[model samples]
Target: MLPFQLAEIVNQGKLVSDEIIINLLSRRLEEGEEKGELGFILDGFPRTMRQAEILEGVTNIDLVINLKLREEALVARCLGRRMCSQCGENFNVASIDIEGENGGAPMYLPPLLPPPQCESKLITRADDTEEVVKNRLRVYHDLTEPVEGFYKARQKLLEFNIPGGISESWRKLLEALNIEDSDNMRSAAA
Candidate 1:
């Protein structure tokens, strides 16, 4: 099972000990290795130096994408974010264009939204509130920021600006990974 799945199990009604977290994560890493998986992405794990050390023992990590954003923008982006209730599609309210508005209003869907429709209203996540987001950011700075330096010293960090937009950053990531043509990168695999 994936580490996140193990995390969900650990998070159910109790706090998971660091030993348990490390064991579960190590097992998942081993499973991925046995299956010959490449370019594994571990989102929101290894928040501590110990965890990073354990990961170093398990396998080599190729790239680390550190998204840099201003604290104000981080809060605003989290506040303006919305998700599809049915399909779990994420969209930012700021990125969507409103129809017949004077450019200050936020809309759930962009003007000239394509069919077929989602039907469900885009809803804000419970954890997206100001207080919760601020706390999360605080925790990140306290626990996770050190990991960036850890990887940076190893020459594996790629810091990207969020205001540059995801698509542009995505292309930069492709370049970082030495992927010349992202379109053909997948087809070549198949």
Candidate 2:
């Protein structure tokens, strides 16, 4: 998922099933259409060529948002990721909101056992490592390429260089959708 924030919460830990993805997306689209809204924020769906075809034919894909991040940056960013010991919370030593007990960030503990000292809410999976992240990113890119082309051909794909990273990327995304403030967006979220 380009927006890894949302789909990363799946309990299956990235072992996503096509049936589950399609079913959820279909349901959301159906609910939206019934209400005459016709909108949804699909994160990390349509992962395969077949899945992309299914999405194109099913909801008709009004639009697609793609973020382009450099491979090195993605690798570096992913490799440096450290998850919380208690709650499966993710953090980057290099990114914002870093916290530590001894005035420094603590080591991530996998779900096997809770840290006696940390007491985090969720367990950091074994897969939250550089090797795993790089592998995941590679798989993500492979899956994303065809979908990008598919939507591009339909004039539904929008790509942002997002060279300035997430905050700038989000600002541009909201602006592109003509969403000036949170009020209008609140309706969908609520």
Candidate 3:
């Protein structure tokens, strides 16, 4: 677990050292193994080549999903993100609508609106500012993007392009994972 000080730094869009992340992950994975969990999923991890090398030393990763989105849309979405100060629930106020260019698929992700009570308590993250988001994107392109190639070389990466809002993209994601959507299953049974 990151100390409160390190967590504060992370909240400001700064990355902690690879040693800190690797140590935390090692302990968590060990605990999961002790419990005999079938598997685990990590989001937004192995952000550096060093971290990937360390992970490879410990366990065999079966698959890695790389979700792709346009940088413009990503910036807008990040800027629109909000959290309730009281309940800490997340929401997005941005409604993205980007036109398809050069045969690329058009993208639209509607904002995740909050309830009436949460609306009054909404707070933007410090790191969600346009400047900070852009900086983080720059850092990702410089440091983390290469991790995609690392997984690709191992034949373990699945590039998934998010085509639209949750409903549309989620269905496509289920298809990619070869998993049946529960809603479809229920409708068929009915």
For candidate 2, the TM-score is 0.63
Whole-model lDDT values for every prediction: 0.67, 0.63, 0.89
Q: For model 3, what is the alpha-carbon lDDT of residue 108?
A: 86
Regions of model 2 farther than 4 Å from truth = 1-15, 31-38, 85-89, 95-123, 182-190
Evaluate model 1: give its TM-score: 0.68
**Error in Å for residue 165 of model 2:** 4.3
Cα lDDT over the full model 2: 0.63
Off by over 4 Å in 1: 1-17, 96-116, 184-190
- Rank all candidate structures by their lDDT, best first, as comma-separated numbers: 3, 1, 2
CA RMSD of each candidate after superposition: 7.0, 9.9, 1.6
Best by lDDT: 3
Judged by lDDT relative to the true structure, which candidate is superior, 1 or 2? 1
Residue pair clashes in candidate 2: 86-120, 86-121, 86-122, 87-120, 87-121, 87-122, 88-122
Candidate 3 deviant stretches above 4 angstroms: 187-190
Clash totals for all candidate models: 0, 7, 0
